[model samples]
Target chain A: MLTIHTKLISAMITQSLKDHPIETCGIIAGLAGSNLPLRLIPMRNVAQSENFFMFDPQQQLQVWKEMSARHEEPVVIYHSHTGSEAYPSRSDVELAAEPQAHYVIIPTCSPHKEEIRSFRIVDQMVIEERVQIVRQYQPELEFQMMVA
Target chain B: MSITVIIPTILRPLTHQQKHIDMEGSRVSEIIDHMDQQYPGIKEKLVANGNAHRFINIYVNDNDIRFQDGLATSLRDGDVLTILPAVAGG
Candidate 1:
């Protein structure tokens, strides 16, 4: 399962809507080896095509360097489907290099009630996963809720 | 200089499923050519018509070769080279 903050989802949705008809792609970085996404990085879609998206090579390199310096890895690799459902295409599954990453897709076909989904793609296999959206991370609050 | 070439998942079949290969080369082109020698037909996937494939992105130690010197990008000992394919976003 993939757990992410509500604020991050909002930001991603906003970006996706702003680039409707064109795909918006980015990575959420997290502490290396932790698998917890905490950083939202919006990247340029150089392809600028309604059917495909490619991160600007220069920007990708810069962000990757920064992540390396901070000892972070791309925990969540996200992209938006402007007119399709929140699912990985055949090409998406074929190009999934980071097997450990949570592949998140947000569908922007309709402005109302967008559906966000996550998946794990490894060795050309796609496995849809559950997404847990949290307002905030509070150990005590979580414990209290569990008890109640 | 010894360089580490990171093979993307899509091209791993050509490299016998190896994710990375250590080779010796001082330039990006030379390393690619050497890789072709080791894994025949691999270069065609990364390059086409005397240039890096449009869908392929090559980076050296987190810096894009296109922004630097393309195929002629200079390399040093222990440099990490990453090759990845451009994928659909929408």
Candidate 2:
């Protein structure tokens, strides 16, 4: 299962709507070993295709290094499917190398009624998981969330 | 001749869970060859048809080998080479 902030979900939906027809991809970074996503990072889709999404190589490296510097890891990897359902395609499964990250697929839809889904794709297997939406993070973690 | 290579998590099994290792070589291709000598089957994951795999991005310091000289990109002492699987899909 995946638990994410409402603000982060809104950010992703806004990004998806703004980049409609062109796939959008990004990651949420959290403290390494924490598994709690605190930062929402929207990446550039270098592919810029309606059906494909690829992060800019340079940007990916920079973000990855920053995560390392901050002792963070990508807890959630997300992308938008403009014309398909919220599910991983065959290619998505074939290319899923992050076995530990939750893969979130959000189909372009009415942001007010979006039904996004999360999955764990490991070794060609795709297992759907539940999503827990929380309005408020722990008071202690709220500071980090605001800082993000 | 000593170059540091950073391995991604997915390929850590081939490197015995080592994410970083010092290798000796003059070119990116040679470094890969040396790594393969130590950890069999890793070369196949990074190279295909005598070229870097399309799904993998290899970097020498801050420069991507694809934008430089592909596998022939020269390496100097203390250069850091990083191998990351492309986060992409259809």
Candidate 3:
């Protein structure tokens, strides 16, 4: 299951809508071995196609190096589906090389409705998972409730 | 010449879970061949049709080999070679 902050989801949704009709992709990085995604980093879709998305080779290398230096990993790899439903396409499964990442898809096909779905595409198998959007992470639950 | 290769998570199994490997080569193709000698199946994962697979990016010292001579891209000692699978889809 993907347990993420609402702010990150909002950012992803906004990016998806902003780049609608052209599939946009990015990754949310976090400390290595920590499932908690902390920072959202958007990648330019070099393909710039409504049906396809690819990261610029130079940018990808740079970002990956930075992540390694920071001792982080891409916890969530996200993209948008402009022409179809929010699910892994044939190409999506073929291109899923990061088995440890949460493949999140934002569907902007409908103008009035917005949806976000997460999946685990490993070894060409797409397994949908539940998303738990929280206002804040753990360790402050009682304090958060009192403040709320 | 010794080239340091930073392997990604997916390819770590082939490297015996070694995050980074040092091998001897003067060019990108030679390095790949040397790696294959040690790790039998990793070459096919990185190369296809005599070229670096389109789905993977091979960067030598922050510059992608594709912008150079591809598999024939020259390399020097102490250069950092990083291989990352492309995060792309339709």
Worst 10 residues of 2 chain B by lDDT: B81-90
Q: For residues B1-90, could you state the per-residue lDDT of candidate 3 as single tens digits?
A: 999999999999999999999999999999999999999999999999999999999999988888899999999989999999998999
Give the C-alpha lDDT of model 3. Answer: 0.89
Give fnat, all candidates.
Answer: 0.50, 0.62, 0.94
User: How do the candidates score on chain B by TM-score?
Assistant: 0.94, 0.99, 0.98
* Model 2: lDDT of residue A54: 85
Q: Would you list the C-alpha lDDT of every candidate in the order shown?
A: 0.82, 0.89, 0.89
- The better-scoring model by lDDT among 1 and 2 is 2
For all predicted structures, in order, the TM-scores are: 0.77, 0.96, 0.94
lDDT of candidate 2 over B10-32, digit per residue (tens): 99999999979999999999999
Q: Which pairs clash in model 3?
A: none
Clash pairs detected, candidate 1: A53-B89
What DockQ does predicted model 2 obtain? 0.81
| DockQ value for model 3 | 0.91
- Mind giving the per-residue lDDT tens digits that candidate 1 earns over B4-86? 99886568889999978998999999999999999999888888898888778899988877789989899999999998776
Kindly list the per-residue Cα lDDT of model 3 for residues A87-114, writing each as its tens digit: 8999999989999999999998974336
* DockQ sort, best first: 3, 2, 1
Better of 2 and 3 by DockQ: 3
